[model samples]
Target: MLPESHASPDRKRRPFLLLVLVLVALLGVGGYVAFQLGGDDRAPVANEPAPETDQPSTEAYQPWFAGYTDLTATPVFTFETPDSESGRDVVLSFIVAATTDACTPTWGTYYTLDEAVEGLDLDRRLARAEQLGGQVIVSFGGLLNDELSTGCTDPARLVAAYDEVIDRYGVSTIDLDIEGGNLRDTVAGERRAAAMATLQENRTAAGTDLAVWLTLPVSPAGMTEDGATAVSQMLEAGVDLAGVNLMTMDYGASRADGDSMAEASIAALQSSHRQLGMLYRLAGIELTAATLWTKIGATPMIGQNDVAGEIFSLADAAQFNAFAQENRIGRMSVWSLNRDQTCGSDYVDLTRVSNSCSGVDQGDQRFSDVLAQGFDSRPTSAAPIKTTEEAGQIGDLTDDPATSPYPIWTEGSTYLADTQVVWHRNVYQAKWWTLGDLPDAPVLNEWETPWTLIGPVD
Candidate 1:
């Protein structure tokens, strides 16, 4: 219930001040994962399982993966509960592990003098989130960092490194934010596609699923030639690419001087949908435009952008949020949750990068709150409250599958009041109509959700 013990009821309010908050935004769960610090330009050398024996490997895969799952679903809420400025309750945090180094993968925003603070104690924070049943998705290859494709040139080792991260974090979804040189590198792109294909196949064989999202820079017009090539590489390599998340802010050279940021974002997404469907046909996997829409996402820089004139204000976020809901897009995110704050009075420059806060007037969590409103489908981590009268009516439900009296507890499945079903080996009954939610996987938000888990079959 609210991740007991991490913070007191009256905890300090500095959003990224606490060490734990900074340390583990999207990093691994167990503890601080020590990485070999090398220059951002350094490509990975294939270190045999010999030297780094402790780093996850094929021989030790099972145990490490078990530890990862034990910690899954909970760490989704990356930051401390949103500050007062957070306009709405946060469901999922886009805990950006940016420009993540391809060599050793520091799994944090790579150090930048521009940032006010580099988050620390992330392992602890993530652990608390897991305990709370929040969720997190680790993003790789930010605009700043050398992508694994560029850094880890060797295909086998690249897959190994990616595999290690997948097992270590137990992340069901991972984002590859390919941009800049890495985005355009045709050779590296091929390697990335191949490695991901292998990784996806391996996970599926293990009875788990891995969703791979490609986050690329986009403009009001649409994906650049290179961007389209990058997506095509994955599809051609058979990487069951989950979605394409467009960076709808900082249109840079592509913006039509004075286009509305929201309009640009919508156009970018619309273009991506059409472009992606065409790619599917080329690969002989025919998906209609409606089907392709589900394979798309949007991530806007919450406030001011790197470009002087291009700003994605709160209004833009609201419009984009509504669009996402209307389209039923697969995912939605803010560029960096760390910067969700207002500029202090003395700090005049909004253009410069500041890690501690957003240069805009979001007042901490406001951007998250406003954009995330009505996104009520997120699985909760809050504990349930019980009452005497209703508790007396509890009873065991049936033991049939999805085809039985009640359909199975599938994600996005809606149920009316008093609907019942079975999940895993457990029985569940919907207290009210609900849909697009897990059966509270971690059982963190027991009091909420229409589906109530009634324990395993006798």
Candidate 2:
């Protein structure tokens, strides 16, 4: 079901808004291609040079994680409250590099989790954390980590693996990080039901509290107004959801703002927190986690463009503290800190984070300490505002081969000009492009054009 907010008679089934960049307008096209080609949620985006901008001060945050660290090897590090603070909130995240068995990718070649894990040497890290009584977790999948996608989407296969992890590692929870991947032609409900069934089955077999966490996309800060409808569609399908983790980093892609990266990221994080949390409530769900990233890249390339030489350093520690204090969010999960540049070598100093990073007493060392303090806080009323004239509506092109992939306004809407709809595949949603810029696009023949179908044109 669409969120009640969008289910009214006046509303149409469409996304909240579209960030249609002319140069990167191809981004939407590429996203559709990746969606169709990969088949689930694992499509790849064309790597392009990111736009440039001045960095904000050390206080703000941006949109997504440019890079991450896997903690599959050593598990334990003790974090303490800073000397002057009484209590501070925290968020700790860990990624699973890989498993031992081979899992086939939906599109690409097959690879084993062992390949990823062995290379990263994360098991020793996990064991170390276990010995020290630190709460080390295992995150499954990433932007292109396709193996887990193969294993996790299937109920039977997922159940077997879930049992093995519990027995072998005594892990009580597992996180699923599904980002740009595949999009199937299958009905949305069918996909959601299948995924949810798998999660429920795996959880039942594990016998412990099994958590399934998802990291979602947020364009810069709270630019979710554009994607809110799409998100509602996802929830209706049943993706075995537990909570949402907003990858609140890299807002504006940081091309324009060079100096104030941290401050920018912080502001974006706060806006994203408020906006997304409101959307979740309007759609009826809980906001479980709010996390930040260590750094963001300038382009789609994996590691080439970092925002600044060093991101979120101790100099910026006060920024995070202040932001968290204002938002009342419980924990702050910094994207894997292992990638941060230290005195000479790259090392993630978790202690540099907040008043809680300094060494503390043993009794205070628990996973609970990592939670953000304001998890229960929320606004009593929805933010007041005037709705956009262009409320939620699907793109002009339906991509349905049954009809010409041309832009046709629905009965309730008006068309200013003819539109072009491109169809890429069976499962693809139609794409719309304005005819204004296309030098050779077919012009709408008003005299012979069908009237009611395109709606009464003004």
Predicted model with the maximum TM-score: 1
Can you write out model 1's per-residue Cα lDDT over 273-383, one digit (the tens) per residue? 655654565456754333455566676765666556667788888887777666556555664454566868877877764544456777434666666654443311111
Candidate 2 per-residue C-alpha lDDT over 1-458 given as tens digits, one digit per residue, 9 for 90 to 100: 00111111000111232222222353222010000011122221111001112222222222211122332213322222221111121112223224444323111122233443464434564565445434433444444434243434554564455445444444544444434331121232234335544655555675434544344444333323323333444454443343344444333343235645445445444334434333443334532222111111111101111222323343344444445444333224444322222222232442332111212222323212222222232111111111121111211322354554444323333334333222321111113333222221111111112221211111
In terms of lDDT, which candidate is strongest? 1
Candidate 1 local Cα displacement, residue 138, angstroms: 0.8
Clashes of 1: 24
Q: What TM-score would every model get versus the actual structure?
A: 0.60, 0.44
Model 2: residues with Cα > 4 Å off, grouped in runs: 1-68, 71-125, 150-155, 162-167, 182-197, 201-207, 223-234, 237-242, 252-259, 278-305, 308-310, 340-458
Q: Tell me the alpha-carbon RMSD of every candidate.
A: 20.6, 16.7
Task: Quote the positional error of residue 435 for candidate 2 in Å.
Answer: 27
The lDDT of each candidate is 0.51, 0.30
